[model samples]
Target: MPNTTDIELRGVSFAYEGVPVLEDVNLSIRSRELICVVGPNGGGKTTLLKLILGLLRPDRGEVRLFGGPPRRGRLRVGYMPQYGRYDPQFPVTVTDVVLLGRLGRGGLAGRFAFYRAADRKAARDALALLGMDAAARRPFAALSAGQRQRVLIARALCCQPDLLLLDEPTANVDTVIEARLFEILRELNRRMTIVVVTHDLGFVSQWVQTAVCVNRTVVVHPTSALDGNAIRDLYGDEVRMVRHHDFLSKGGHDDE
Candidate 1:
């Protein structure tokens, strides 16, 4: 079942308040494929993820997950949005935040129900996966941006999803943390499909098999297509292509 298609978007177009975002987008993601979505700012990267997650209805065409509507299949999908969107003022502990991922697992009516022992165990296990177990009881707001990002990833992992979606997973972390994070993700990809939305290709090229370049329109390309010309076609010529090794060696901030 490794070749099983887990996500598909056919002629999908979307708009926000009458402004066109994605247009006639067609994308297919198979099981256990590690993908990185890259694009310039305001290029509909996050919006595409939302559409795949079933959070937004496409203005035209269709989005399907696991051969069904997104709503039905999103339960098996884990999502981590951008880190900048949070206020970092939550009084909840790290464990409590991760448990939020289990919400609605038992359906809408059980959303507020007490967390089962299994749920707590799953949360702990996810935290452990991110090496954040020691800080499980720490105040969420007190952690640095890197630590919070790890906690959020653990939250997404708490679902034990068949598909995992992440936005700007390496936004605040340094190169060292980014390397470690990708190491964990590469390991996770053995069991689940991963679609990461990041701005930089070099940071993720070592792990991702494909690159989904998003803009007003969407295009899917193999990672090998990421030469200077391809990058300029997506980004402008002003942007330089950074090799993964050169980037890590420079200790560059690969923020999104």
Candidate 2:
């Protein structure tokens, strides 16, 4: 049997103030699939993500999440944005940050509920999943860049989402932590569909099964079928393909 569809975009087109972004795009993402979305900067990567999140309405065509309108399925989705700003001196613990995920369960009223015992437990479990439980009481600003990213991911997981979306998750982290993060994501993929927007093609080839190349249009290719020529087609001739082995040879460590 075919896998259940988690996301579908049919002839989707979007433009910002008459400047075209994505046009004539059709794609489908299936359950438990790990996908990497790669494209040039400003080539509609973020636009496509917004469409999937129902944060933007396409100029033309349709977007469906789990066979329904995207808005209808929002609660089942967890999103970690590319850049999030936080005050270094903000008096918030890692556990407190993760509990923010539970706010979606009851909206404003639930947030004001001061986070019930169950919410605390769920947050703790999410932290444990990322091996971040020990840092739960640490001030958010006290963690490293990689640890912060993991905490944000834990926050996303606290929602108990069936689908996880991450944008440039490895952008600010070292190679070792990046590899570890992908290991965590790979484990999560056994139970949830994951879509990540990344520029690290080597990591994509190593970890994900599918690649979605988005420019003015979008094309989906199985990672095994992705070749240097295919990457050049998506990123142009100036782009170079770095093998995963080369990355690891340069003091990059893989998850044990």
Which has the greatest lDDT? 1
Residue ranges of candidate 1 with Cα displaced over 4 Å: 107-112, 224-256
Candidate 1 lDDT tens digits, 1-256? 7999999999999999998878999999999999998876666889999999899999999999999999999889899987677767767999999998888777544466688888999999999988899999999889998898899999999988999999989888898888898899999999999999886676676677888877667778876776667755645521433343234345443433
Best TM-score goes to which candidate?
1
Q: Write the per-residue lDDT of candidate 2 for residues 130-198, one digit (tens) a residue.
A: 789999999998998778888888888898899999888887788887888889889989989999988
| lDDT (CA) per prediction | 0.84, 0.83
Model 1 pairs in collision: none
In order of appearance, the predictions have TM-scores of 0.86, 0.83
lDDT agreement of model 2 with the native: 0.83
